[model samples]
Target: TIFLDEIGELTNSAQVKLLRILETKEFFRVGGTTPLISDFRLIAATNRDLKESVLNGKFRADLYFRIAGTSIYIPPLRERPKDIPVLAYKFMMELAQSKGVSFGGFSDDALSLMMAYHWPGNVRELKNFVEKALLLSEGRVIRARDISSYFEEHSEFGRSLPTKFDSSVPSQLIFDNLQKIWEELKAIKMKLSEIETEKKLSSGSETLNIEETEKKLITSALEKTKGNKVQAAKFLGFSTKTLYRKMKKYGLR
Candidate 1:
Protein backbone atom coordinates (compact mmCIF):
# COMPACT_ATOMS: atom_id res chain seq x y z
CA THR A 1 0.00 0.00 0.00
CA ILE A 2 1.20 3.49 -0.79
CA PHE A 3 0.32 5.78 2.11
CA LEU A 4 0.43 9.31 0.79
CA ASP A 5 0.49 11.51 3.87
CA GLU A 6 -0.58 14.63 1.98
CA ILE A 7 -1.49 13.94 -1.62
CA GLY A 8 -2.80 17.49 -1.85
CA GLU A 9 0.76 18.71 -1.63
CA LEU A 10 1.43 17.17 -5.03
CA THR A 11 1.31 19.83 -7.70
CA ASN A 12 -1.42 19.86 -10.33
CA SER A 13 1.02 18.41 -12.85
CA ALA A 14 1.95 15.65 -10.43
CA GLN A 15 -1.71 14.94 -9.77
CA VAL A 16 -2.29 14.57 -13.50
CA LYS A 17 0.65 12.20 -13.67
CA LEU A 18 -0.79 10.20 -10.78
CA LEU A 19 -4.10 9.97 -12.61
CA ARG A 20 -2.36 8.50 -15.65
CA ILE A 21 -0.63 5.93 -13.43
CA LEU A 22 -3.89 4.87 -11.77
CA GLU A 23 -5.77 4.51 -15.01
CA THR A 24 -3.12 2.79 -17.12
CA LYS A 25 -1.08 0.88 -14.50
CA GLU A 26 1.88 2.83 -15.82
CA PHE A 27 4.22 5.35 -14.27
CA PHE A 28 7.61 7.00 -14.68
CA ARG A 29 10.18 8.22 -12.20
CA VAL A 30 10.99 11.88 -11.81
CA GLY A 31 13.31 11.71 -14.82
CA GLY A 32 13.47 8.07 -16.01
CA THR A 33 10.64 6.39 -17.91
CA THR A 34 10.54 2.87 -19.30
CA PRO A 35 6.74 2.64 -18.90
CA LEU A 36 6.98 1.16 -15.40
CA ILE A 37 4.14 -0.74 -13.72
CA SER A 38 3.46 -1.17 -10.02
CA ASP A 39 0.78 -2.85 -7.92
CA PHE A 40 -0.17 -1.03 -4.75
CA ARG A 41 -3.17 0.39 -2.94
CA LEU A 42 -3.31 4.13 -2.42
CA ILE A 43 -4.30 5.99 0.77
CA ALA A 44 -3.99 9.72 0.91
CA ALA A 45 -4.58 12.27 3.68
CA THR A 46 -4.80 16.03 3.60
CA ASN A 47 -6.05 19.09 5.45
CA ARG A 48 -6.48 21.16 2.29
CA ASP A 49 -9.42 21.35 -0.08
CA LEU A 50 -8.35 19.38 -3.14
CA LYS A 51 -11.48 20.23 -5.07
CA GLU A 52 -11.04 23.99 -4.72
CA SER A 53 -7.48 23.41 -5.76
CA VAL A 54 -8.74 21.51 -8.79
CA LEU A 55 -11.18 24.29 -9.69
CA ASN A 56 -8.42 26.82 -9.38
CA GLY A 57 -6.15 24.45 -11.27
CA LYS A 58 -4.02 23.84 -8.20
CA PHE A 59 -5.14 20.19 -8.11
CA ARG A 60 -6.11 17.86 -10.94
CA ALA A 61 -9.76 16.78 -11.27
CA ASP A 62 -9.36 13.34 -12.83
CA LEU A 63 -6.83 12.40 -10.18
CA TYR A 64 -9.26 13.15 -7.33
CA PHE A 65 -11.94 10.98 -8.94
CA ARG A 66 -9.55 8.09 -9.28
CA ILE A 67 -8.26 8.28 -5.73
CA ALA A 68 -11.75 8.71 -4.33
CA GLY A 69 -12.88 5.26 -5.39
CA THR A 70 -13.95 5.21 -1.73
CA SER A 71 -13.49 8.07 0.66
CA ILE A 72 -13.64 8.14 4.46
CA TYR A 73 -13.89 11.59 5.96
CA ILE A 74 -12.57 11.92 9.50
CA PRO A 75 -14.17 14.37 11.97
CA PRO A 76 -12.09 16.86 13.85
CA LEU A 77 -12.02 17.00 17.68
CA ARG A 78 -14.21 20.08 18.02
CA GLU A 79 -17.26 18.41 16.45
CA ARG A 80 -17.18 15.38 18.71
CA PRO A 81 -17.88 17.18 21.96
CA LYS A 82 -18.90 14.02 23.82
CA ASP A 83 -15.59 12.43 23.04
CA ILE A 84 -13.65 15.30 24.60
CA PRO A 85 -13.86 14.33 28.27
CA VAL A 86 -13.33 10.69 27.41
CA LEU A 87 -10.27 11.46 25.37
CA ALA A 88 -8.90 13.89 27.91
CA TYR A 89 -9.25 11.48 30.83
CA LYS A 90 -7.89 8.58 28.85
CA PHE A 91 -4.95 10.56 27.59
CA MET A 92 -4.26 11.98 31.01
CA MET A 93 -4.24 8.54 32.61
CA GLU A 94 -2.06 7.01 29.94
CA LEU A 95 0.16 10.03 29.91
CA ALA A 96 0.61 9.93 33.65
CA GLN A 97 1.39 6.26 33.62
CA SER A 98 3.85 6.72 30.80
CA LYS A 99 5.58 9.35 32.87
CA GLY A 100 5.71 6.96 35.87
CA VAL A 101 3.63 9.39 37.85
CA SER A 102 0.54 8.27 39.78
CA PHE A 103 -2.40 10.59 39.23
CA GLY A 104 -6.08 10.64 40.08
CA GLY A 105 -7.31 12.90 37.25
CA PHE A 106 -8.39 16.38 36.29
CA SER A 107 -10.76 18.47 38.34
CA ASP A 108 -14.35 18.57 37.05
CA ASP A 109 -14.06 22.27 36.24
CA ALA A 110 -10.90 21.73 34.26
CA LEU A 111 -12.45 18.82 32.41
CA SER A 112 -15.49 20.88 31.44
CA LEU A 113 -13.34 23.75 30.30
CA MET A 114 -11.25 21.43 28.18
CA MET A 115 -14.38 19.97 26.68
CA ALA A 116 -15.87 23.40 26.03
CA TYR A 117 -12.84 24.74 24.21
CA HIS A 118 -12.35 23.78 20.58
CA TRP A 119 -9.20 21.95 19.71
CA PRO A 120 -8.18 23.37 16.36
CA GLY A 121 -4.91 21.46 16.20
CA ASN A 122 -6.85 18.21 16.87
CA VAL A 123 -5.58 15.09 18.65
CA ARG A 124 -1.92 15.85 18.22
CA GLU A 125 -2.47 19.18 19.91
CA LEU A 126 -4.59 17.66 22.67
CA LYS A 127 -2.00 15.01 23.43
CA ASN A 128 0.82 17.57 23.66
CA PHE A 129 -1.21 19.85 25.94
CA VAL A 130 -2.00 16.98 28.31
CA GLU A 131 1.68 16.32 28.71
CA LYS A 132 2.16 19.69 30.38
CA ALA A 133 -0.54 18.93 32.94
CA LEU A 134 1.17 15.69 33.82
CA LEU A 135 4.38 17.56 34.46
CA LEU A 136 2.91 20.21 36.78
CA SER A 137 -0.01 18.74 38.71
CA GLU A 138 -0.17 19.67 42.40
CA GLY A 139 -2.35 17.06 44.08
CA ARG A 140 -2.41 14.17 41.63
CA VAL A 141 -5.23 16.14 40.02
CA ILE A 142 -4.64 18.06 36.82
CA ARG A 143 -6.26 21.47 37.08
CA ALA A 144 -6.81 24.34 34.69
CA ARG A 145 -3.59 25.87 35.80
CA ASP A 146 -1.68 23.02 34.27
CA ILE A 147 -3.13 23.46 30.79
CA SER A 148 -4.29 27.11 30.47
CA SER A 149 -0.89 28.03 29.12
CA TYR A 150 -1.62 25.95 26.08
CA PHE A 151 -4.80 27.88 25.18
CA GLU A 152 -3.11 31.21 25.83
CA GLU A 153 -0.12 30.52 23.64
CA HIS A 154 -2.07 28.82 20.82
CA SER A 155 -4.75 31.54 20.65
CA GLU A 156 -7.27 29.15 19.04
CA PHE A 157 -8.68 27.69 22.23
CA GLY A 158 -10.01 30.62 24.26
CA ARG A 159 -7.52 32.14 26.59
CA SER A 160 -8.34 32.95 30.24
CA LEU A 161 -11.07 35.58 30.55
CA PRO A 162 -10.75 39.29 31.42
CA THR A 163 -7.02 39.09 31.87
CA LYS A 164 -4.65 41.69 30.55
CA PHE A 165 -3.18 39.27 28.01
CA ASP A 166 -6.00 36.79 27.40
CA SER A 167 -7.64 36.38 24.00
CA SER A 168 -11.32 36.03 23.17
CA VAL A 169 -11.83 32.47 21.95
CA PRO A 170 -14.58 33.16 19.43
CA SER A 171 -12.84 36.22 18.03
CA GLN A 172 -9.45 34.55 17.79
CA LEU A 173 -10.82 31.51 16.01
CA ILE A 174 -12.84 33.72 13.69
CA PHE A 175 -9.93 35.96 12.89
CA ASP A 176 -7.62 33.03 12.31
CA ASN A 177 -10.16 31.25 10.15
CA LEU A 178 -11.00 34.34 8.10
CA GLN A 179 -7.36 35.10 7.56
CA LYS A 180 -6.75 31.62 6.14
CA ILE A 181 -9.86 31.68 3.98
CA TRP A 182 -9.07 35.13 2.64
CA GLU A 183 -5.58 33.98 1.79
CA GLU A 184 -6.90 30.88 0.01
CA LEU A 185 -9.57 32.90 -1.74
CA LYS A 186 -6.93 35.34 -2.85
CA ALA A 187 -4.73 32.54 -4.16
CA ILE A 188 -7.61 30.92 -6.04
CA LYS A 189 -8.66 34.30 -7.38
CA MET A 190 -5.14 34.87 -8.64
CA LYS A 191 -5.21 31.48 -10.30
CA LEU A 192 -8.59 32.26 -11.80
CA SER A 193 -7.17 35.53 -13.07
CA GLU A 194 -4.29 33.68 -14.63
CA ILE A 195 -6.66 31.10 -16.17
CA GLU A 196 -8.75 33.89 -17.64
CA THR A 197 -5.68 35.47 -19.08
CA GLU A 198 -4.75 32.09 -20.53
CA LYS A 199 -8.15 30.74 -21.64
CA LYS A 200 -10.38 33.76 -21.20
CA LEU A 201 -12.54 31.83 -18.74
CA SER A 202 -14.55 34.46 -16.94
CA SER A 203 -15.82 33.81 -13.41
CA GLY A 204 -19.09 35.49 -14.29
CA SER A 205 -19.48 33.19 -17.24
CA GLU A 206 -18.14 30.01 -15.66
CA THR A 207 -20.88 27.39 -16.04
CA LEU A 208 -19.70 24.82 -13.51
CA ASN A 209 -21.74 21.63 -13.23
CA ILE A 210 -23.21 20.43 -9.93
CA GLU A 211 -20.92 17.43 -9.78
CA GLU A 212 -17.98 19.70 -10.34
CA THR A 213 -19.15 21.97 -7.53
CA GLU A 214 -19.57 19.04 -5.13
CA LYS A 215 -16.08 17.84 -5.91
CA LYS A 216 -14.75 21.27 -5.07
CA LEU A 217 -16.66 21.33 -1.74
CA ILE A 218 -15.47 17.86 -0.83
CA THR A 219 -11.94 18.96 -1.54
CA SER A 220 -12.43 22.28 0.22
CA ALA A 221 -14.20 20.72 3.19
CA LEU A 222 -11.55 18.07 3.45
CA GLU A 223 -8.92 20.76 3.57
CA LYS A 224 -10.81 22.82 6.15
CA THR A 225 -11.64 19.88 8.39
CA LYS A 226 -8.21 18.41 7.99
CA GLY A 227 -10.11 15.74 6.07
CA ASN A 228 -13.26 16.11 8.18
CA LYS A 229 -16.50 17.57 6.75
CA VAL A 230 -18.63 17.46 9.91
CA GLN A 231 -16.36 19.95 11.59
CA ALA A 232 -15.78 21.96 8.43
CA ALA A 233 -19.50 22.59 8.02
CA LYS A 234 -19.76 23.60 11.65
CA PHE A 235 -16.95 25.97 10.92
CA LEU A 236 -18.82 27.15 7.85
CA GLY A 237 -22.17 27.07 9.74
CA PHE A 238 -24.03 25.43 6.83
CA SER A 239 -26.98 23.09 7.06
CA THR A 240 -26.76 19.54 5.71
CA LYS A 241 -28.96 20.18 2.71
CA THR A 242 -27.18 23.38 1.92
CA LEU A 243 -23.88 21.62 2.01
CA TYR A 244 -25.40 18.79 -0.04
CA ARG A 245 -26.61 21.24 -2.63
CA LYS A 246 -23.08 22.52 -2.94
CA MET A 247 -21.76 19.00 -3.28
CA LYS A 248 -24.40 18.17 -5.87
CA LYS A 249 -23.71 21.38 -7.69
CA TYR A 250 -20.03 20.46 -7.81
CA GLY A 251 -20.81 16.88 -8.91
CA LEU A 252 -18.85 15.68 -5.88
CA ARG A 253 -21.25 13.27 -4.19
Candidate 2:
Protein backbone atom coordinates (compact mmCIF):
# COMPACT_ATOMS: atom_id res chain seq x y z
CA THR A 1 0.00 0.00 0.00
CA ILE A 2 1.15 3.55 -0.72
CA PHE A 3 1.81 5.47 2.48
CA LEU A 4 0.59 9.05 2.75
CA ASP A 5 2.49 10.04 5.89
CA GLU A 6 6.10 11.02 6.33
CA ILE A 7 8.64 8.42 5.16
CA GLY A 8 10.88 8.85 8.15
CA GLU A 9 8.14 7.64 10.48
CA LEU A 10 8.09 4.25 8.76
CA THR A 11 9.30 1.54 11.14
CA ASN A 12 12.87 0.38 10.68
CA SER A 13 11.69 -3.18 10.08
CA ALA A 14 9.20 -2.05 7.49
CA GLN A 15 11.98 -0.09 5.84
CA VAL A 16 14.09 -3.25 5.67
CA LYS A 17 11.30 -5.12 3.93
CA LEU A 18 10.70 -2.19 1.62
CA LEU A 19 14.36 -2.03 0.65
CA ARG A 20 14.40 -5.79 -0.01
CA ILE A 21 11.30 -5.45 -2.14
CA LEU A 22 12.79 -2.61 -4.17
CA GLU A 23 15.93 -4.61 -4.86
CA THR A 24 14.17 -7.91 -5.53
CA LYS A 25 10.42 -7.62 -6.07
CA GLU A 26 9.78 -9.72 -2.97
CA PHE A 27 8.97 -9.03 0.66
CA PHE A 28 7.50 -10.37 3.91
CA ARG A 29 5.01 -8.95 6.36
CA VAL A 30 5.66 -8.46 10.09
CA GLY A 31 5.52 -12.25 10.08
CA GLY A 32 4.91 -15.09 7.61
CA THR A 33 7.38 -15.04 4.71
CA THR A 34 5.72 -16.73 1.77
CA PRO A 35 7.88 -14.37 -0.28
CA LEU A 36 5.06 -11.94 -0.97
CA ILE A 37 5.90 -10.36 -4.32
CA SER A 38 4.36 -7.39 -6.06
CA ASP A 39 5.13 -4.29 -8.11
CA PHE A 40 4.18 -1.17 -6.20
CA ARG A 41 5.32 2.37 -5.52
CA LEU A 42 6.00 4.14 -2.19
CA ILE A 43 4.95 7.51 -0.83
CA ALA A 44 5.37 9.12 2.60
CA ALA A 45 5.27 12.45 4.35
CA THR A 46 5.80 14.16 7.73
CA ASN A 47 6.45 17.56 9.32
CA ARG A 48 9.38 16.46 11.47
CA ASP A 49 12.94 17.30 10.60
CA LEU A 50 13.90 13.96 9.07
CA LYS A 51 17.45 14.85 8.03
CA GLU A 52 18.25 15.92 11.59
CA SER A 53 16.50 12.79 12.88
CA VAL A 54 18.74 10.77 10.59
CA LEU A 55 21.87 12.37 12.06
CA ASN A 56 20.47 11.74 15.54
CA GLY A 57 19.92 8.08 14.62
CA LYS A 58 16.16 8.27 14.90
CA PHE A 59 15.76 6.96 11.34
CA ARG A 60 17.32 4.10 9.40
CA ALA A 61 19.98 4.90 6.80
CA ASP A 62 19.27 2.06 4.38
CA LEU A 63 15.50 2.60 4.48
CA TYR A 64 16.07 6.29 3.98
CA PHE A 65 18.08 5.46 0.91
CA ARG A 66 15.21 3.37 -0.47
CA ILE A 67 12.38 5.91 -0.05
CA ALA A 68 14.70 8.83 -0.75
CA GLY A 69 14.43 7.92 -4.44
CA THR A 70 11.13 9.82 -4.80
CA SER A 71 11.04 12.18 -1.80
CA ILE A 72 8.54 15.00 -1.90
CA TYR A 73 8.19 17.63 0.81
CA ILE A 74 4.99 19.49 1.59
CA PRO A 75 5.16 23.03 2.94
CA PRO A 76 3.76 23.81 6.38
CA LEU A 77 0.40 25.57 6.88
CA ARG A 78 1.91 28.87 7.95
CA GLU A 79 3.25 29.44 4.45
CA ARG A 80 -0.22 28.89 2.98
CA PRO A 81 -2.76 30.74 5.11
CA LYS A 82 -4.66 31.41 1.90
CA ASP A 83 -5.72 27.77 1.92
CA ILE A 84 -7.22 27.97 5.42
CA PRO A 85 -10.66 29.22 4.39
CA VAL A 86 -11.10 26.66 1.66
CA LEU A 87 -10.02 23.75 3.85
CA ALA A 88 -12.02 24.96 6.85
CA TYR A 89 -15.14 25.32 4.71
CA LYS A 90 -14.71 21.87 3.24
CA PHE A 91 -14.18 20.26 6.62
CA MET A 92 -17.01 22.23 8.18
CA MET A 93 -19.37 21.09 5.47
CA GLU A 94 -18.47 17.45 6.01
CA LEU A 95 -18.76 17.83 9.76
CA ALA A 96 -22.16 19.50 9.47
CA GLN A 97 -23.44 16.72 7.29
CA SER A 98 -22.18 14.15 9.75
CA LYS A 99 -23.78 15.96 12.68
CA GLY A 100 -26.96 17.10 10.85
CA VAL A 101 -26.23 20.66 11.85
CA SER A 102 -26.30 22.84 8.77
CA PHE A 103 -25.48 26.34 9.90
CA GLY A 104 -24.37 27.50 6.49
CA GLY A 105 -20.67 28.49 6.83
CA PHE A 106 -18.01 30.64 8.37
CA SER A 107 -18.53 34.35 8.22
CA ASP A 108 -15.92 36.31 6.31
CA ASP A 109 -14.53 37.67 9.58
CA ALA A 110 -14.40 34.20 11.12
CA LEU A 111 -12.56 32.98 8.03
CA SER A 112 -10.13 35.85 8.46
CA LEU A 113 -9.30 34.70 11.97
CA MET A 114 -8.73 31.22 10.63
CA MET A 115 -6.39 32.56 7.97
CA ALA A 116 -4.40 34.61 10.48
CA TYR A 117 -3.75 31.49 12.55
CA HIS A 118 -0.15 30.20 12.41
CA TRP A 119 -1.33 26.56 12.20
CA PRO A 120 1.90 25.12 13.67
CA GLY A 121 0.10 21.81 13.91
CA ASN A 122 -0.39 21.78 10.10
CA VAL A 123 -3.34 20.62 7.91
CA ARG A 124 -4.39 17.80 10.22
CA GLU A 125 -4.77 20.43 12.87
CA LEU A 126 -6.84 22.56 10.51
CA LYS A 127 -9.17 19.60 10.04
CA ASN A 128 -9.63 19.03 13.77
CA PHE A 129 -10.15 22.71 14.36
CA VAL A 130 -12.92 22.86 11.78
CA GLU A 131 -14.67 19.78 13.16
CA LYS A 132 -14.52 21.09 16.70
CA ALA A 133 -15.78 24.44 15.45
CA LEU A 134 -19.14 22.97 14.44
CA LEU A 135 -19.63 21.86 18.03
CA LEU A 136 -19.82 25.40 19.45
CA SER A 137 -20.91 27.35 16.42
CA GLU A 138 -23.66 29.96 17.05
CA GLY A 139 -26.50 30.19 14.54
CA ARG A 140 -25.28 30.61 10.96
CA VAL A 141 -21.80 31.77 11.84
CA ILE A 142 -18.68 30.55 13.66
CA ARG A 143 -17.28 33.21 15.93
CA ALA A 144 -13.84 33.67 17.45
CA ARG A 145 -15.09 32.40 20.80
CA ASP A 146 -16.44 29.15 19.36
CA ILE A 147 -12.91 28.13 18.46
CA SER A 148 -11.38 28.70 21.93
CA SER A 149 -11.92 25.17 23.18
CA TYR A 150 -9.96 23.71 20.27
CA PHE A 151 -6.94 25.86 21.06
CA GLU A 152 -7.22 25.15 24.75
CA GLU A 153 -7.34 21.42 24.09
CA HIS A 154 -4.39 21.59 21.70
CA SER A 155 -2.24 23.65 24.08
CA GLU A 156 -2.75 21.07 26.85
CA PHE A 157 -0.63 18.35 25.17
CA GLY A 158 -1.37 15.82 27.94
CA ARG A 159 -1.07 18.45 30.62
CA SER A 160 -4.12 20.06 32.25
CA LEU A 161 -6.33 22.00 29.88
CA PRO A 162 -6.18 25.75 30.47
CA THR A 163 -8.99 27.63 32.19
CA LYS A 164 -11.94 28.16 29.80
CA PHE A 165 -15.55 29.18 30.40
CA ASP A 166 -14.62 30.37 33.84
CA SER A 167 -18.24 30.89 34.91
CA SER A 168 -16.98 32.68 37.99
CA VAL A 169 -15.80 35.49 35.77
CA PRO A 170 -18.39 38.28 35.59
CA SER A 171 -19.98 39.22 32.23
CA GLN A 172 -19.73 43.04 32.28
CA LEU A 173 -16.10 42.83 33.22
CA ILE A 174 -15.49 40.40 30.39
CA PHE A 175 -17.02 42.78 27.85
CA ASP A 176 -14.99 45.65 29.27
CA ASN A 177 -11.88 43.52 29.16
CA LEU A 178 -12.56 42.61 25.53
CA GLN A 179 -13.18 46.26 24.74
CA LYS A 180 -9.97 47.31 26.45
CA ILE A 181 -8.15 44.71 24.44
CA TRP A 182 -9.62 46.09 21.22
CA GLU A 183 -8.87 49.70 22.12
CA GLU A 184 -5.28 48.79 23.05
CA LEU A 185 -4.58 47.39 19.62
CA LYS A 186 -3.15 49.31 16.64
CA ALA A 187 -6.52 49.12 14.81
CA ILE A 188 -10.13 50.24 15.41
CA LYS A 189 -12.87 48.19 17.06
CA MET A 190 -15.84 46.68 15.22
CA LYS A 191 -19.48 46.61 16.41
CA LEU A 192 -22.39 49.02 16.19
CA SER A 193 -24.49 49.87 19.21
CA GLU A 194 -27.56 51.64 17.84
CA ILE A 195 -27.73 53.20 21.28
CA GLU A 196 -29.48 56.16 19.65
CA THR A 197 -26.09 57.86 19.57
CA GLU A 198 -23.25 57.78 17.07
CA LYS A 199 -20.07 59.68 17.89
CA LYS A 200 -19.35 62.26 15.23
CA LEU A 201 -15.71 62.52 14.25
CA SER A 202 -14.35 66.04 14.65
CA SER A 203 -12.16 65.74 11.53
CA GLY A 204 -14.53 63.32 9.70
CA SER A 205 -11.87 62.95 7.01
CA GLU A 206 -9.66 60.45 8.88
CA THR A 207 -11.44 59.01 11.88
CA LEU A 208 -10.15 55.53 12.78
CA ASN A 209 -11.32 53.80 9.54
CA ILE A 210 -13.77 50.87 9.84
CA GLU A 211 -11.38 48.18 8.57
CA GLU A 212 -8.64 49.19 10.99
CA THR A 213 -11.08 49.29 13.90
CA GLU A 214 -12.56 45.84 13.32
CA LYS A 215 -9.13 44.33 12.82
CA LYS A 216 -8.23 45.27 16.37
CA LEU A 217 -11.27 43.42 17.74
CA ILE A 218 -10.64 40.35 15.62
CA THR A 219 -6.99 40.39 16.60
CA SER A 220 -7.86 40.74 20.27
CA ALA A 221 -10.35 37.88 20.10
CA LEU A 222 -7.92 35.65 18.22
CA GLU A 223 -5.10 36.45 20.61
CA LYS A 224 -7.19 35.78 23.69
CA THR A 225 -8.05 32.35 22.35
CA LYS A 226 -4.51 31.77 21.05
CA GLY A 227 -5.68 32.57 17.51
CA ASN A 228 -9.06 30.93 17.99
CA LYS A 229 -11.81 33.46 17.26
CA VAL A 230 -14.67 31.00 17.63
CA GLN A 231 -14.10 30.61 21.35
CA ALA A 232 -13.27 34.25 21.79
CA ALA A 233 -16.64 35.32 20.38
CA LYS A 234 -18.47 32.78 22.50
CA PHE A 235 -16.62 33.95 25.57
CA LEU A 236 -17.73 37.45 24.67
CA GLY A 237 -21.31 36.09 24.18
CA PHE A 238 -21.56 37.56 20.72
CA SER A 239 -22.84 35.66 17.70
CA THR A 240 -20.33 35.20 14.92
CA LYS A 241 -22.64 37.35 12.79
CA THR A 242 -22.70 40.07 15.41
CA LEU A 243 -18.94 39.91 15.61
CA TYR A 244 -18.75 40.11 11.83
CA ARG A 245 -21.12 43.06 11.73
CA LYS A 246 -19.08 44.81 14.35
CA MET A 247 -15.94 43.89 12.46
CA LYS A 248 -17.46 45.39 9.34
CA LYS A 249 -18.78 48.45 11.16
CA TYR A 250 -15.35 49.11 12.56
CA GLY A 251 -13.59 48.29 9.28
CA LEU A 252 -12.03 45.03 10.52
CA ARG A 253 -12.49 43.59 7.03
Task: Name the top TM-score candidate.
Answer: 2
After superposing candidate 2, which stretches have Cα over 4 Å from the reference? 29-33, 152-253
Cα displacement (angstroms), candidate 2, residue 3, comes to 1.8
Window of ten residues with lowest summed lDDT in model 1: 205-214
Model 1 segments beyond 4 Å from truth? 26-36, 93-103, 156-253
Residue-wise C-alpha lDDT for candidate 2, range 92-139, written one tens digit per residue: 645654665533356556766666656767788888877766675532
Model 2 RMSD, rounded to 1 decimal: 15.4
The 10 consecutive residues of candidate 2 with the worst lDDT sum are 188-197
* lDDT of prediction 2: 0.58
For each candidate in turn, the TM-score is 0.52, 0.54
lDDT of each residue in 14-50, candidate 1, tens digit only:
7777787778888777699588889888899987787
Angstrom error at residue 87, model 2 = 0.8
lDDT for predicted candidate 1 compared with the true structure: 0.62
